[model samples]
Target: MYNIGIDLGGTNIAVGIVTKEGKVLKKTSVPARAERPFDQIFADMASCIRQLFAETGIKESEIESIGIGTPGCIDTEKGILIFAGNFKYGKNIDYRAEMAKHFDIPVYIGNDANVAALAEVRAGAAKGVKNAIMITLGTGVGGGIIIDGKIFEGAYSAAGELGHIVLISNGEQCSCGRKGCWEAYASVTALVRQTKAAMLANPDSIMNKTPLEQVSGRTAFDAAKKGDKAALAVVDQYQEYITEGLADMINIFSPEVIVVGGGISKEGDYLLNPVREKIKSRVFGIGLLPDRKILPAELGNDAGIIGAAMLHA
Candidate 1:
């Protein structure tokens, strides 16, 4: 049987027909148009799903379930999107019920980051692992935790908010309205912020060697590779903050694996090696420290869609 997975993001909605073995048989993308009415976005989504089925020549009788990964807080049991900042029109929408009404199939929905992490655990990087945590260091840091192969959604369905955890006392403010959150200093946006600040501080530095618009994680990597001191320093600073957060997670959860995903993870060993080393060296319970291995996410962008599909399982 086939399963349908939908990645309902801020910009676009991606749908796919996935196999039981986690292979995507067919996939397509359509504009989310979140600025428009919720009904319009839902209609686009329905059309996308129907197109996917037609392309795959799969009938409704052959489908097992449909899973949706949406941004923001969600009431999984009720299939309601409580607060999705990306979609101004999605708040309080009963997505599962609506989708079920249109498709007549079992529907499952959850927070996007949580479902992405769950997908990696089930079929991506963390496959075969019993316990792990996932961190997506993107525009902001998003987190998810898996224990015994199941996602640990806290009592309020907001568990695994690793990024919002306090790292510094009354320091940088976060989008969550808190101060000194780990994400404020460890995300890709944070990296860019740090890079820009450093460049401004040392106008003569090689970072000023590149155009501001071209500055990104890769830019930092390129400069570091060229032995640019300022860029190296920025990377060092970012990694230090990231390590502190991971070390705390290691101490608390003792997870067997930590899967780092998102654009920053493209740095691969450049990012994972140092974070792993720092966690190993600094964590409190040294002897009892779990067999923590930091690995890059394998599924890339598809993890969210694939993971969302498995929510019904």
Candidate 2:
């Protein structure tokens, strides 16, 4: 039977029909218009699902379940979204009840990062592994942990927030209201901030040519590739920040694989290689155990949908 996966984001609500093996058969999306009431957003999601059903000529009875991957805190046991930073009015939303109003199929919900990790373990980079960790370095860092091939939500279904772990005390402030969070140093947003600061310090740097407002996650990496000293410094420091957290994770969990996702991971080996090399010295008992693999995520954007669909698996 087919499963429905919904990737609910600030800008869009993407829905897909996925097979048991995690392949998306058909997908469609609608603008989330997050400023509106939660009921309106739910209505749009239901309407989109109906449209998918009509376009694919699939009977409702053929669907096994509907799962959602959403941002912010999720109470999966009750299918409630506790809080979402992007939405204007999403608080303690009973998502399962909302979906129940439209479809009788079983409903499941998970934190977006958690589901992405699940997708990787089920069909992407860590497909064959039973233990893995996924880190998404976007506006903020997002993390997911898998143990024994299942998502570990901890006691409150709020575990695996690896980004909030502090790497430096009283250093850079984080959006999460913490000081020196790993996200404050290792996220793509952090990279942009670092690039801007570097350009400001080195007026003659190649990166200075771009307006500060235009500085992005790639600014430093691009300039560094061109052999710009200031840019290289920024990239080097950012890589070290990433490695510090990775080493901590390795020492704590010792997972078989750590999958890197999000915009910055697109840098591929340029990013992974340095982090992997540096992580070697930081992990505990480094040479005594088999080397852990740090790999870029393979599924890209599809990871959220495929992972959400596999919630039933």
Candidate 3:
């Protein structure tokens, strides 16, 4: 009658009872306490699940399975959390086996971004598309690729790392010890850095009114709206960086649709329209194919949870 989806993140763990249609019927959350031992972390997870079932009066027999969307590489076949930047453990945290010990239902695991992409394709922006990519512009750029109505994890479940792709040669350094990574240029981190740099360069820019520590992704857009030349320049440069990465992805996969999500995505059409234009003309062989559509993600944070639940699909 229902499924359970758990979104396990560095700072929080959210559990939800979901319907077959990908609707979250009941949900609860707690601090992730990620620094603790993996077993204790999972004990917290199991406890949260028990609380949700009790509150909703949902029985184990009525549940089809339990799924988790986590931040890191995942071995979907074995339901292991291979490696996560924010997670304390590294390599082969047997999440499925551990969670299964506490529940009778099948347990599955997937990369958080991949599961969110699945949710978008199944019930959000790309609902009817057979192929799509979901890009999240947060502290860093995160992505998920979908093909033929299924999540494409690639061999070793390490594919779809769209952000790590090199965008410039010998360019900005990335957290992954690489240079010119798409993330280093197009992520919110880069945007804020760009905004601050611009503010410092032009002391009279409208952006100067904002504190240096508060130069957010929106600073440029807001100041640009007020006709600040410095701010507008930053917005233009950031958009160009984003477009370059998107064009590369289109050239590689050319998915039928791209769903952009995350904090910066709240800019909506102001962001999608320009990126759409660049991708349309820049992707290889664009003269023969229909324009690939770029749409904002519909499900927001719930995409991961709903998608995790649908892992059994």
Q: After superposition, how far is residue 11 of candidate 2 from its true place, in Å?
A: 1.0
What local distance difference test score does each model get?
Answer: 0.86, 0.91, 0.88
lDDT of 2 by residue, 214-258 (tens): 999998999999999999999999999999998988888889999
TM-scores of the models, in the order given: 0.96, 0.97, 0.97
Candidate 3 per-residue lDDT, tens place, 131-171, comes to 89999999889999999988899998989889999989999
Q: In model 2, which runs have C-alpha deviations exceeding 4 angstroms?
A: none
State candidate 3's TM-score. Answer: 0.97
Q: Which portions of model 3 show Cα errors greater than 4 Å?
A: none
Off by over 4 Å in 1: 287-290
Q: What's every prediction's RMSD, in angstroms? A: 1.3, 1.1, 1.2
Give the winner by lDDT.
2
lDDT of 1 by residue, 71-107 (tens): 8888888888888875676578998767866788888
Best by TM-score: 2
